[model samples]
Target: MSLPPTFDPVRALSLARETLSIEATAVNAMADRMDDSFARAVALVLGSSGRVVVMGMGKSGHVGRKIAATLASTGTPAMFVHPAEASHGDLGMITAADVVLGISNSGESEELTAILPLIKRMGVPLVALTGRVQSTLGRHAAVVLDASVEKEACPHNLAPTASTTAQLAMGDALAVALLDARGFKADDFARSHPGGALGRKLLTHVSDVMRSGDGVPRVRLDADLMTLMREISAKGLGMSAIVDGEGAVLGVFTDGDLRRLIEKSGSSVDLRALTAREVMHPNPRTVRADALAVEAADLMESNRVTSLLVVDDAGSLTGALNSNDLMRAKVI
Candidate 1:
């Protein structure tokens, strides 16, 4: 019986690292090759009134789906259609206004090439990401992005590996460049991704989670300290607004203030004799009711305060918000 070769983990790691280094070098080389072709490709997609239709096959199809998703999330409207499916009547999904971005390493993928003439007949512009610039698909394309790799990470040079990675990165580059060209803002991204954390931070407003009017824990400036406690507990906000006869916020008294006051006075006993005005912190940090939730969070952190009264442009108390509100809004 032949003896089993001894395991060499060190050699295995070195080879893996070498593969990654080679792939990195290949990607760096592409940066220098980027030229007018990239600009033309961007112009074509930006000028199109319809979505960018991305199509590929096998591993290329998987990469295309991700590229489509990235483009869609970053302000470019795009969708993936499998080439095999396109031959089965999915070709109808492509419109004259659209731009087709076909990805194939060899640029000779039969399924993708088969649909080229039909797409051209419909007047849809084609962008090809391929290694072979002289291949049929590249030759037919209106713009070709060279995603060539010198070698595959696969020891036998059979797997896609480095080629696919380069394609994915190139897709990202297009999506980001298009995003900037369109002046797509964080708020725009938030609208498309309302369920994501970035959406919450950018879309949530002070009015969305603030306690308004009677819901805000507030007591008249003349109210006793005992009345203040009742107001805070009743509203469950751990703080009470000290308001004047005009209902304008004069100051705020928080649980922290009460604790400190109690410690200073050497008594947690009856203090109803003292009014809320005497113990409140004047001119507490405030936010406008129309301010972004993220701004409110910033104010809270910078002021070292947990809560802020929401006021209108006229300085009239409109609502109240706390760190808990920001958390609930996912702005934290």
Candidate 2:
């Protein structure tokens, strides 16, 4: 059968605009309603020495998982326990040291309510995020976080649209508050997300991925040009450092320098008599071994080079890291 052409586009657009406006207003209302109870909920989770167990049913459970993830990543240890699973022995996961955060817009989900008594019996501090302050779960909870909204964004007023959004926003608020309260920093966050780019940027050090010792292409300042060429060819770094008797990096001879030297004095000239100090570029770009790999990559990119010399606090050569090393570390 052919689709009807008489569908009202104007009415559909009007309803869409009305729903968006209503949801926007509802979120603003929820933000305005945040009070001391919200603070209490955050404090309860923060003070708990054990994990925060979040439990709910349906959409609330889905929102609870996201809340638990946010809390866990932001330094507040948290995990989600499905209400149905809690009744089927998962409740054992809840302990007296844990703080139970229960989410239910109606505050009367049977599956969620069924395990409430057990949570209470375990002496777990209860923090409820619900629309009704007088609801059973809210009344039983040690802290009642009001996530009430005026109406559902759904046209039929049945789907959990506005309520879930409000719940998610409230969860974010709690996570951020706890993050700031606990002084959680980016480095701490990186530790939890070690596989992510942020971890590569923050946790990686120059020494961790750098080429070091004999693997670092280098030559004594008095070495002949031919010997320097041999060092560069064998090391595969396309450049060789010129060093003093004490092993201090004096300068560098690079592929670009070789090109220039060839152009100025014919490549056929005997290079053995030439000293490394005569052809090496003095004071090459360097980075401390402990510096972040991101910084090293930035230095290499800014200076228009492919590699960086890694040095100790006293300016002694510790290693050498190239752009490829940063790529391998995922710092790029």
Backbone Cα, N, C clashes tallied per candidate: 0, 0
Candidate 2 TM-score versus the reference: 0.91
Off by over 4 Å in 1: 1-7, 267-270
- The candidate that wins on TM-score is 1
Clash list (residue pairs), candidate 2? none
State in Å the error of residue 70, model 2. Answer: 0.8
| Candidate 2 residue lDDT tens string, 68-130 | 999999899999999998899999988899999899999999998888888888899999999
Q: Return the top candidate by lDDT.
A: 1
Candidate 1 is scored at a TM of 0.94
* lDDT scores in order: 0.90, 0.88
